[model samples]
Target: MNLFIGLLNMAIEKDNDRALYLVQKAEVLAEIELFYLLPHQRRWRSWFPEVIYCRVDVEKTRIYIKEAIKKGKWNMDDWPEMKHKILKLLSIDDAIIDLAV
Candidate 1:
């Protein structure tokens, strides 16, 4: 879409640390989500399915969102408060094994 292209261009032109950080964070989240789909969702997928396929896979989005956590840094260029809150969403004592899965 033209709007999407425009936004991308703006993000690229800004040369802002917040923009860069957000872009990198989004890429990491996308990479994590890209492969995490159930069989039924996979069947529903299609080319350029950004609204569905490309979006983060919420283990069961059909259910309510009890929390919203993504491991690692989720802060702005200088917002440690946000980082702490976001990281605390889903505390995992043993995530390495789950990361492998």
Candidate 2:
């Protein structure tokens, strides 16, 4: 976590567009993993609710989504649609969305 933040900070400090792009990509991937794990990880879920939420009606939503995706629930082309959902779930506010884009 510290390493990720350090790289992101360096990208911003240097104003390097390519590095910024890579950092953003890394951020998205990390957040997806967080989203997938948060449900089962009680400590993480308790720690992060103030920071973000997801579109779910009940528990195990993340697990179900992961299973579905693994079982051909979405095609490669469908990921573009889901990407925005993942971003929204990971974001704490409008500022986060702005930074991500």
Candidate 3:
């Protein structure tokens, strides 16, 4: 998770390649946890079903990447409009971030 956050920060800084690498790493980690680890952790299994968690993680990463890209393209003053536009176009619900953990 820390690595993913670092990658998100890097993406916000406009380091596209590094951000993509980090996103890929995050995806792999999600896959591992969903496919391998979680199955054995029955207590957690009810709350974090594999398919749902994996999809949510991927979606969150996508949203972070899109937001970072928009942030890079515009100055802070323009961010509100940019974020609004991107969110609208992407159809990304703000509620997803809260549910992502």
Task: Output the number of the lDDT-best candidate.
Answer: 3
Clashing residue pairs for model 1? none
Kindly indicate the candidate among 1 and 2 with the higher TM-score: 2
The window of 10 residues in a row where model 3 has the poorest summed lDDT is 47-56
TM-score on alpha carbons, each prediction: 0.24, 0.27, 0.27
Cα lDDT tens digits, model 1, 21-89, are 466546644554567655566555353245522334444431222222233222234575654453345
Off by over 4 Å in 1: 16-44, 48-101
Candidate 3 residues lying further than 4 Å off, grouped into runs, are 1-16, 40-101
- Model 2, stretches more than 4 Å misplaced? 16-39, 42-101
Better of 1 and 3 by lDDT: 3
RMSD of each: 14.9, 14.8, 13.3
lDDT of each residue in 1-101, candidate 3, tens digit only: 58666766667577566546556666766665667675556347564455432233557756675566555542335667776665666676655433432
Candidate 3 lDDT score at position 35: 74
Q: What is the lDDT of residue 50 in candidate 2?
A: 35
Model 3 reaches what TM-score against the true structure? 0.27
Score each candidate by Cα lDDT: 0.45, 0.53, 0.57
Instruction: Give the Å error, residue 39, model 3.
Output: 4.0
Model 2, 10-98: lDDT tens digits are 77677866535565755655675666565566356454443433334434554554444556563435566575575356442334334
Residue 73, model 1, lDDT: 28
